[model samples]
Target: MTAPLLSVSEISKRYGAVVALEGVSLNVGAGEFFALLGPSGCGKTTLMRCIAGFETPDSGKLTLKSADLSGVPPHRRPVNMMFQSYALFPHLNVYENVAFGLRRKGEREEAIRARVSELLDMTQLAPFGARRINELSGGQRQRVALARALAPRPALLLLDEPLGALDRKLREETQFQLKEIQRKTRTSFVIVTHDQDEALAIADRIAVMRTGKVEQIAAPIEIYEKPATRFVAGFVGEMNFIEGEIARDDGAAFVTSFARLPRAECALPQGARATLGLRPERIEVSRDGEGVAGRVEDFVFRGEYTLLRVRVAPDVVLRVGAYDGRFAIGDDVKLTIAPDAGVLFAESE
Candidate 1:
């Protein structure tokens, strides 16, 4: 395997009594699109600042390639960070904004012109180079910011909530553009975002953080289908968690709930407390009365699919995804899961 382009080993940071990052360690492969994902105050932004040299860690080390980056100034580090605000200078035109960093570094005017022109073309902003920053639309401003960040040709590019400034539709469109730009430049990107959908949509690998620590790190599908913990399963997407105890039926592990659920990966001993995570899409709903009984409580018609909330027991409500809204509220239904539908984890987790 090739060596990672960036490595963070046991990095920790604190502000007064607040803990921002606690022994966080991870690596970014060369040219890989990596994401630091979590809710607010989960240390993702702090970790990005540490990597960009804006905030120093209390302990541990950060290295780009093989060289240690400790005490390296932000401007000296071979990295550029794009802020969520897009931060383009209002007085400057798009071309001058993109050329700012190169000019600041004392690059020859000819080289700066070439680099800025190449970035503008690569970012699809060649025609808008002469436009004032205030005249560009939100998405255009975002592209300009990205182009400016790339002008220096850094080895790594860090983005903090890159699409936070745009509307949902534009953000989705820019996600593809960002991925394409990364592909063309082949620069390692570490994006910090609270939006799980955004991370899943663009990152090659996602590190899910919680309470100043990493909860899980894996590909999007693995993080969703086979979450390492209950928090990860619940946070990454919609999940129904059933509280139960592990029981053995014919030497096979099963979760004793409203119904016996056979799980192949249950490692706990018999009678151990556990939770079964069921994705809404994994549960099949039908009115044929062929599976566990439930009553539809409510439903939402999403364009692609319908989401139904069903009350299975007095205290248990499960969300089920169906292709159509065939069942209405107050309708009786049956829910069934595939043999390998759910993931099991300790209840304490």
Candidate 2:
């Protein structure tokens, strides 16, 4: 009987024969940082646009604060969008850029200045208010965009690839600032991103979309540690899938050609085809141990961990995340996996 802050029900969109969204439905609670994460062309953008009223769904309904959004224009809705391009006015200085929405609404100069000052301080752009948009750095420009979007105090804010333009180093640093600002403002944020790391870092919940459908929706840890489906397991993180079938003889293990996998943490029916989804960090690589023997096919030295691709069988390869980079190419290694480190997904036909 009660309504959420934002609700989308069975929203479907089709561009001619191509289906951009199919029965997509989700809800964003007040002050929740939700992420729409997926690869390109998965319809994340379409769903966000539909929420913003820029694109109307053919067969479903959206409600914000229990009010129907049907036929509502984008600007009329109590929602603001921060585009991927930042969309700041090049000629308008930072202060004016953030104050544009308030001025457009004909707010008195005194009130506009106060609200703009508050947002600038909250977004850490107070000192840069007088700077031209063209003279600001990428991260500073992003802050201006955020401050502008939040100035209107809309119930919801839609961000389309907000950090896509920033370099990796800057993007990583800005992620913390973004989340902090969102927390301080308490505005519900729906961010569309292709970066899994970004989603894991910033979102309170993530909806993993594929082929226009939401495959799974959960907290980031739930998305990574207990993915609901095979598609979700593969999409959210670096998962090593061991193809096997459920074996009834054992308590509940995937019967793989290489070996009978450790008892799966998840339940699967007997004789059902199942896939074991293991994170690289779950498998420990050692020179010698009571574990599966495999030879290192190759290895890459990441800053915090060494990722080793080991051939454990003729047809199976497992990636192990090691804290040390002592592994060399063609070296024999042992991969130790705990019984509960992996979750099993029933393979669909």
Candidate 3:
């Protein structure tokens, strides 16, 4: 197997007393589309900045192709960042904006024009070569920024919320185009975004972050199906955190108990305090019957599926998705969690 393209080793960062990242280590393979995903203030941006050489880490090392990147200036590194704001030059037209970096490197005018035109054509912005930045739409401007960032043909590309500025429809369309571009160019892309759908749609692997730390890193489907922590389970998608105490472990299985549910099966773990995490969609809802009975507090008829807020207990209101059956508010429902689908997370962590 080929060596990893990038390896982050025990990297830590701090803004005074506030710890922004802690011993976070990850590896990215060549040509892989990696994503850093989390809500705001989770240090996702900080980690990306560290990788891009915009922010220096307090401890540990960053390596690209086994070479340390410490003290390497952002401009000197073989990595380029596409900012969230799409920092395109206002005065430069599309061609000039895309050619700016090539010119700075002292490339001949013919080479600059050729490369610029090629990228413009690739991004489908060739016809807008003479248009000023202000004349273009948000998606157009975004493509310009991408072309500029990719102009130098950097080995690794870091994108920070690159689609946040566009409308939903445009963003969705651009997402596919971005993925296609990456695939064709074979550039190692690292994108940071809080939009789960965007990350799931484009990324080869996602590093889910929370509170300055990485909660989990895996393919989107694996992250959704088997979350490593409670934070990850709740962050990636809607989940019901049912408080449960481990009743027994037979070295191969576990049992849990709650007031409304008894002996719920879980993965074997020798722990007393734990929480059962079940995804909303993993639950099967039916008329009040054998499973845990609950009264539907509210029902929303979404286009593809229905969302029900079920009051299972006085204090716990679990969100459940019903894709088939339609239930009215105050309707009694039976909530059943697939025994194999429920995940057990150790509460202490």
Candidate 4:
């Protein structure tokens, strides 16, 4: 149990009458990749800025290695931030941009040169070091920004949507690169992102926020498979929710839906109102009438798989993922789900 690299305790912030962060607290383990994830206005960015000294909390404390950092300035704190914009100096070449931080600290020219060269090589930018910032591609500039942020060798690095500027293909590629670089550097990273997929792809743990409070904090798989709330279940990925009340027939428990569903878990008592969550990919659709009957209302091909919207009831449309794309609109189909594929939560969860 090594001490956490950074600890935020009961931190709160406000903008005039608007509350930005409300008693948000969390710990960042040494060398861990953590993410603050939520949609806009969820207080994620505010918390990140508080850590970077760009914004001050109205109460609570921030600590680094057991020392308080209440009055520290941004540059004086043992942290650096990489903005979504990359923030590379237009007038400087890649090498000089990375060397900017070290040179500001009055390091000897030889030492600065050595560090800059090492970072460039590590980031795979050795061949592009002499090119100006405008000459580099979006991904190249992102690497340059990362190299510059890591140049100072700070205790922690804060990333505010580091990959938001790139196209989908490049963004996915850079996510792996970012994870690899973090592993190599072994520096604690706290990334703030609204992109759920990116956070799930890269973060060791994620804190899902909403309305200036944390909804849940856990590993990606846990958050997706065993969500703490209905919001978490719906937000992390695509889910089909069916509202029903628990019922008992003979010795077995079931939910009153268009098709009676066997209990997945026994936490809720019989007659209690609850919602059943089913992931699109977990459902199997067929035309042989092996399960609940439904009609294919519409579908869209998504390359690796196809999303079929099936109408089981007048108001209930369930989204199902089919790998074969064999069904078409107006086709009658049957949908079946494994007993353990569904999750049950209270109606108000």
Candidate 5:
């Protein structure tokens, strides 16, 4: 947000007839953990490659620390990339693998040793530096790759789904560890991920991309509570959408069939086509309540909570949460939308 650590200006890329990146532009601040989040084939990978100098853009400029990156090769740029596969050398021990880059840069052996030891200790790989890559668990191997990338202390570190290979439990734990290391090192990080939970849990800010363009760039809470587009609302979390036209009249706000929606959360023109976007937890389900009528159609037993699907209209089956087992399928119920809970988006967005 300050003078950016990295600046990407109107970058575009293509392959034959297909466009991989189209005028994508963003800025990464110093010591910020920024995330580029989207589904597969969304051009996040392409953008990362461009920053790493692995892929050149068809047009645009990239600058880091006020220095132009045009025509700069990957090795010459003050940036490092950690691949998803944890590209550790099988023949080298952990210490040697981490010290490889430093040695390549012609640092003295004593300085390389001290730096490698510090990094190994930081990543909790100090105890296993003498072991070969094959002898370590997946989590340990990941830490090794992370340490190797951080050894040189580059101004920017690019992580291409660095935890993709770890199991879910380990990945969750490592997320916090990664953040701690980034904090201690104070190095700017730009991570590429398709997992929404990962981005929300780890990033200082997120840029949600779709088909080569950034849809929204904001902190995790804003991206969830005030989505810039419908695609962002659907991609970030579990959301229910209902379409309607805005009406300022206190008398009639309906098309005669759907449940009455709350006042729009945003400013919209009178009679403009709009939509109500509410998260599942925003709706309260009860057997006898002063609200819209519906029936329990199905249920999903999620640990620590239960999810109920209530069909309130012919085509609208709103998913609401039910903590107790008081209701069953085919039971009549009332659905109440919490006051000041839903967000309104232009129907065309």
Candidate 6:
């Protein structure tokens, strides 16, 4: 493995009594698109700020190419941050905004013009160089913001919820565009976002945070398929959680027994409490079959997919997918899950 472009080691931060981040560590390879994903107030932004030199951590170390960034100022560090709001100067034209960093560095007028022109072409905004910030659409403004951040040729780029300001349709379109731009530039990108789909779609690796801790760090597919904890299993996507006690654990398989469960699927350990996690999409529902009997409580049609809330045990209601089935609200259905499709999690104390 080559040396990481950026590495954060055991970083911790606190705001008086509230702990913002604790012992968070991550490594990003050169040119990799890494995402810090979590809900609001989950310390994703704080982590990004720390890397950008805007917020200093209380402990631990931040390194860029093996060099400490503790005392480095934001402008002096070989990093540039693209803010969520685009942060475009209202009074400056597109070219001037992209050229702002060059002006600060005291580059000659002719050199600034050439560098800005190249960036404009790189971002496909060459024709809009003369347009004012307010004149560009949301997607165009996003591109301008990206161009401005990339103009300085920073070794690493930090993005704070880069697509949060765009509407749904535009956000989806710009996600791919941003990935392409990152690949073209070959710059390491650390993006902070709360949208799971966005992280899964754009990032080479994702660090899922909760409260002030990283729950899991893995590729999108691995994180979605083999979540390490109950929090991760529940947070990453839709899941059916069935609670029971472990009847057996033989390393490979664990059986959990519930009152209504016909047989122990896989036991964990004798007397251990456990929960089975099955993704909604991985579950198969049939009109008539020998499986878990459940009554359809309600469902919503979502054009490309359907969501069904099925009442299984009296205490548990499972959310399942109905990709093509048209079972009515009051119909009974049998839900069958492939043994390998579910993961068993030990119940949290």
TM-score per candidate, in order? 0.97, 0.97, 0.91, 0.97, 0.96, 0.93
Tell me the tens digit of each residue's lDDT in model 2 across 40-94.
Answer: 9999999999999899899899999989999999999999999999989999999
Model 1: how far residue 46 lies from native, Å: 0.9
Tens-digit lDDT track for model 4 on 1-349? 8888999999999999999999998999999999999999999999999999999899999999888999999989999999999888999999999999999999999999999998899889999988998999999999999999999899999999999999999999999999999999999999999999999999999999998999998999998898898888888999999888877654435555577777555677778888888899999988876898899999989889989999998889999999864888999999987778868888778
- Residue 153 in candidate 6, Cα distance off native in Å: 0.7
Range of the 10 consecutive residues with the lowest summed lDDT in candidate 4: 248-257
Q: State the lDDT of candidate 6 residue by residue for 182-276, as single tens digits.
A: 99989999999999999999999999999888999999999999898888888888888888765433333434332333333554556677787
Cα lDDT tens digits for candidate 3, 312-347: 778778889999878999999888865576688777
lDDT of 5 by residue, 165-282 (tens): 9999999999999999999999999999999999999999999999999999999999999899999999998898877786667633422146666563547866888777789888
lDDT of each: 0.91, 0.91, 0.87, 0.91, 0.90, 0.87
* Pairs of residues clashing in candidate 3: none
TM-score, cand. 5 vs. native = 0.96
Which stretch of 10 consecutive residues in model 5 shows the poorest summed lDDT?
A: 251-260
| Candidate 1 TM-score over all chains jointly | 0.97
Better by TM-score, candidate 5 or 4: 4
Report the error of model 5 at residue 3, Å. 1.3
| lDDT computed for candidate 4 | 0.91
With a 3 Å backbone cut-off (N, CA, C), the pairs that clash in candidate 1 are none
